[model samples]
Target: MKKSSMKNRLRPLLLTAVSLTVAVAVSACGPADEGAVSAKPTAAGVEPSTGRPTTPQTSPSSSASSRTTASRSPTSARTTSTSTPTPKQAIVKNTAAPRTRAAWPRVTFARLTFEIPPGWTLTTYGSDACVQPVHRAGLPTMFDCAGIAIKSGSIAGNELRSYEARQPGGWYAATDVQPCPVRPTLADGSFNGITSGTSSPPVESGLRPVGSRKAAYDRWTAACTSGYRFSPQAWHLPVSRVLFLDYTGHAETARVLESVRFPG
Candidate 1:
């Protein structure tokens, strides 16, 4: 009976030992299985049996496309530089002035041709002709010819006297030379005594430069019935039958009269 009890105790210890050895064997095998799993190829186009990584082959078109995409990406992200411009200025210049024009054309009456300046108009009365300034609206009508006056019509007393004073050539000696029907003689014996004396006669009375030759001229005062006073200063040439008379004593009239001449 003691021998049987000893065998039972040894059997229990043997069973415990066998179980511990099995647990140690399983833990040791777990690391080796994990290493095998890691060694297997996982990348595309790789052989799992060989366990070696494969080099993927590329097409020419795919390589070109990848290069183009990389180039275009940098263009979209990059920035370009800009610059500013300046403006210009303006300029100016200079020039000259204008000129003055001359007077009107020459005029002729009977054998007398002369320049009447720019400001006079000519009119005809029957066979007689005369010129008057534009400013003179109403004035005595002066005639150019004494015979033309008698043939055409009788001249006014004021106009007749003016005509006589202007005609130093003694061209006209009509019986109707008297200005007034009954007039006062301006030159009495006393004035004649002063004039006849060799004391230098009036400078304007004898020959002086006029038109194209020596001309006779004199100053005289007339009494008008209208109560207005006037001194008809005049220059006359007997040889050329030309006369310039200014009864109103206007400076412009004198200028025009001085400019009168026979045109070539």
Candidate 2:
């Protein structure tokens, strides 16, 4: 019975050795890139892992793997981003217009509009009410000025026009625009008689035109301490003549004149 028992133990060990040898041999013949066979340890030239070769998903363009093993079909994780919205702005429409105003005394002298000094009177140099515009002799040619008719009361432009038409060009010596100095301020620092004082009324502004500007530009200065240099566009009408009244004078008066605007 002891001898039979020894035989039995030896037979079991032999059977175990045979089984392990066959399993290893079968695994060596299978696809190496598939499954975990590549991880099985071996001695010498034993077959590598059966898992398919795996590739690093470094970039979409890369197709090669680091080693032969089971391959993992690349799982692409693609994500997209959205944009943000912007705010709206409010707009205002400009529908209002600027207003133009007319100042008083829109008075006429030598067929020009000008500011008259308060408490002052004007008189004509000639006996005929319809004589030509003449000025005091010995004054600068560019400083042309006429003694306007302001007897008893200021003459209405309409009333004067009617009376003037009795003669040619509305006056015995009908005159066109004269080259008056811009302001009464003289270059030689002389005012003949021009002087200034406070408590005197503020200067009223005037506007005039300079035409197409082909005429000679004779710029000169004289004494009109209270007056200013002025210019304007001239438009002659059948019954009315257009003359721009521009002049430069004292500092304060010049400031007011700058506000006058020209039309297109």
| lDDT score for candidate 1 against the true structure | 0.46
| Residue 185 error, candidate 2, Å | 18
Per-residue lDDT of model 2, residues 1-264, tens digit only: 999999999998999999999988988985666456645445334444467544423432342452222243222111122233345586888878867644423233344333433322333433212111234354322223322221112221221443221121221112233333333345786552322211122232222223222211112222335354332211122223222212232232222222222223
Give TM per candidate: 0.36, 0.24
Candidate 2 lDDT (Cα, whole model)?
0.32
Give candidate 2 regions above 4 Å deviation. Answer: 1-85, 93-104, 111-215, 220-264
Model 2 TM-score, 2 decimals: 0.24
**What does candidate 1 score on TM?**
0.36
- The RMSD of every model to the true structure, in order and in angstroms, is 21.7, 15.9
Cα-based RMSD of candidate 2: 15.9
For model 1, give the RMSD to the true fold: 21.7
Model 1, stretches more than 4 Å misplaced?
1-101, 126-128, 134-208, 225-227
- lDDT by residue (1-264, candidate 1, tens digit) is 999999998998999999999999988886557778666555446554455554554567887898899998766666322233345565554455556656666775645555555666665655455466566434443233211111122322232333443333222223333232112223442211111111112224545565556656655544333233444455655445445545435545544454555545
